[model samples]
Target: MSTKLALLPYAAPARYSRDERLRITRLAGALRLALNIHPGNGLVMVLGHGGEKNNLEALETWVQRSLEAQALPPNRASLQPLLAQLETYLTHWEADK
Candidate 1:
């Protein structure tokens, strides 16, 4: 006789750990490997603002440090599109309240 596993109740989305976030960021980066503001880049900014109020300055600082440490150049020209994407993400963040 065939038996089925017990059904489990639905649960909320699992919270991501630091490593999980990093992994996700890396994967995102890979998908947009050519972009100036890829997932790897956004990951830092996203983490800083996670579950907290929006802090543009803090997000900017985190992005700057992450890029600088990696020896990436300071080029806002390449960053504009990414900035726009971030703004959109931030809008959704605010709406979650």
Candidate 2:
């Protein structure tokens, strides 16, 4: 028997200030570099098989540590969109399982 899965509703693209957009662009570049340099390592391993909850927790912890290391304020508004994207990805991944 075949099973049909319900599709998730579309989400509107997030709006960002110029500074926030720059930050997001830089972050994406960094992630691409890391993945290219160390395929199947570190964060990839954590997010790969750790399940959704653990993946989110690990991502949050990494974000916190990165902010601390950079001496940045604890304001996470700029990252909310990125987090939301990750959450949506995780939800879809779980459904596929």
Candidate 3:
């Protein structure tokens, strides 16, 4: 028996639930702000040959920070601002459509 790992197609778009979308949207926005990255740039996933990506070092820093945040005691004060921002973005998204 042999074990193999298959690489999925790069162009495929995966489905995400509304909550999942909102969570990631907020995370990306916060990371962009923290790292001072332009709106046109900074994503971990490279969609194609010329896709944008966050600063590699900055992204690593974000990962470490997020993991650390999760490990700490729940603090609503820390998350409230991000949640508020997410709510504003989501509201605007609906209004735009």
Q: Which numbered prediction scores highest in TM-score against the true structure?
A: 3
| C-alpha TM-scores of all predictions | 0.31, 0.31, 0.33
The ten-residue window of minimal lDDT in model 1 covers 2-11
2 against 3, candidate with superior TM-score: 3
Write candidate 3's Cα lDDT for 3-47 as tens digits: 232222333333546764455445545645654555443333421
The backbone clash count of each candidate, in order, is: 0, 0, 0
Q: Which stretches of candidate 3 lie over 4 Å from their true place?
A: 1-11, 40-97
| Tens digits of lDDT, candidate 1, 20-85 | 445434433432343334333334434353432333333544444444344444443435444444
Model 3: pairs clashing at backbone N, Cα or C within 3 Å:
none
Between the candidate structures 1 and 2, which one is better when assessed by lDDT? 2
lDDT string for model 2 (1-97, tens) is: 3334432232333454677545644554443343342333444333433332443343433443444444444344535544454455545655666
Question: Considering every candidate listed, which one attains the maximal lDDT?
Answer: 2
Give model 2 RMSD, 1 decimal.
12.2
lDDT of the candidates, in the order given: 0.41, 0.43, 0.40
Native-vs-model 2 lDDT?
0.43
